[model samples]
Target: MKKTLRNTILGLTVTALFISGTLCGCGKKAPPIPASRLDFLEIEVAEQEKYIQEAEAKYLEERAKLEAANDSKGVRLLDTMNRERLRNEKQILKKQQKELEKLRQSEANKK
Candidate 1:
């Protein structure tokens, strides 16, 4: 009976020491996730960049076509329309560029 009681006390002491050792290690460390990974905004910025590029390309092409055409009523009408279209495309490009900047700023703020 005395041997059994001594064995039980030893077992309990070892178990308590193991549990204390495990819990002691947990309090001193930081969390797993870093600050940068919590908020990601690159994908939206990339999409906005793509949209701005395409809009700029289209605006430049229409401006060139407007410049090359001979002056006539139809040509004048087309030129007017192309000019309007180019203006709209530029506005869209500007808007997309702004969105990209905003996304980048938001991402930077997260870090």
Candidate 2:
């Protein structure tokens, strides 16, 4: 019984070491990032910013037009658009709050 227990413990220790060695051996070298890809990412980000600005401008312009119109359909459509904009704004505010909370928690952890 003593021999059997010793063998079992030894086998587990050996198995654990083997697994750790195997895991450590599997770290592969990362490929270098290309300069051209970095440039492409910058260009894409600029384009996206431009597109978002354009979209916001268009929505604001449409909203003003809706507000100016006094017709029933215009009023209904404006109300719908306003509701949607409010909903989207609420979601954005919530997401910003969450990000702020995460930043605060991380800063606290650092301190």
Candidate 3:
């Protein structure tokens, strides 16, 4: 009975340590991104910028058409959808930019 209790306590302690280490990330850092990956990220950012510009132009054109037709509802709906889409796209772009910056910084540190 005493041995069984000691074993149970040891097991609980080990389990707690494992859980804590996993939750705390084990003090590990991410692997560095290569220069090729950075170049790809730059290209991706450029493409995203171009896509955003095109989307804005298209939204304006559509808005103009709806206004000319005097369709207030269509205009409102289009505006809402465009706003949401732009918001999501911009968020993605911002996240990518941050990642790129982080990788670049890490690369610079290595140099």
Candidate 4:
């Protein structure tokens, strides 16, 4: 009987102390920080800076690929135009040669 009574009193005392400590806010909760004490802008700036850097990198890579494709297209166009020009020049030269030959034949007939 004495052992059980002593255990009961000890349990009650522990319960009372727990209740008092909880009401006193004796647990480890940090105090609320004032807005001026927080570095919210700094944290946001860092994240935005990271996002901007990634965006720039992506833009540069895409622009490089686009420019390379455009350069290839330009080269192919120039080649096609140059081939057309050469063909026209060849045709004009042949016509001029034929006219010269006709004049020579006429001069021989007159002699």
Candidate 5:
């Protein structure tokens, strides 16, 4: 009788938790950002794009100078460094873009 009672209590507790979880909703949507915040994000993304372009141009110019000097080792080192920098910058840009997109999506959903 004690074993049966324990099993019944466990089952009841599990069912109650399930019902509460379902009612509470697992994925709550975030509130939309304000228009000014959206604008700021847009500006940030644009600045990031510009920065990436400038970095690429600078890298190309430096690479050309190294090639002209015939410093193969220096050229290789520069290539490695520039590639890592660009990769990091691009990742940041991607993150900013994603945030902007999410904000836009939330704003649209709010309407």
Candidate 6:
């Protein structure tokens, strides 16, 4: 009977130690996810960059074509349209650039 009581006390002491050890912060935390794996904004930024490049290229091509053509009503109309497109595209590019910056800022905040 004495042996049994000793063993029970020993077991309880071991369990208590274990519980206290676990309650004490072990200095272990889940590692932060790798930024490259977590980041989805990069893809969108790249796509927007491509779109901006293509728009600028098309505008330049149209301007060159206009410059080569003799001044006529149709040419004037096309130039006006091209100018509007350029303005609109520039606005879109600026907006997208701002969005890209915001995404970058948010990504940095996660670090």
Candidate number with greatest TM-score: 3
True-structure Cα RMSD, model 2: 15.7
Q: Give the clash count for model 1.
A: 0
- Tens digits of per-residue lDDT, candidate 2, 1-107, equal 99999999999987776555643445543333435533444444455556556766776777677677746687677668766875776566555556556655776
Worst 10 residues of 1 by lDDT: 30-39
lDDT of 6 by residue, 1-111 (tens): 999999999999867765556433563443334366225445555666787688778867776676778546756787788779768867776776677688778879989
Q: What are the lDDT figures for the candidates, one per model?
A: 0.62, 0.63, 0.88, 0.59, 0.86, 0.68
Query: Could you tell me every candidate's TM-score relative to the true structure?
Result: 0.39, 0.37, 0.67, 0.34, 0.66, 0.47
Off by over 4 Å in 5: 1-35
Q: Model 1, 43-68: lDDT tens per residue? A: 44465567657866775675667567
Candidate 5, lDDT over the whole model? 0.86
Q: Best lDDT goes to which candidate?
A: 3
Candidate 3 C-alpha lDDT tens digits along 25-111:
565543344359788798789889999999999999999999999999999999999999999999999999999999799889999
Q: What is the C-alpha RMSD of each candidate to the true structure, in Å?
A: 19.6, 15.7, 11.2, 37.6, 12.8, 19.9
lDDT of 4: 0.59
Candidate 3 lDDT score relative to the true structure: 0.88
Off by over 4 Å in 4: 1-71
Which window of ten consecutive residues has the lowest lDDT sum in model 4? 29-38
> Which regions of candidate 1 fall more than 4 Å away from where they truly are?
1-71
Pairs that clash in candidate 4 = none
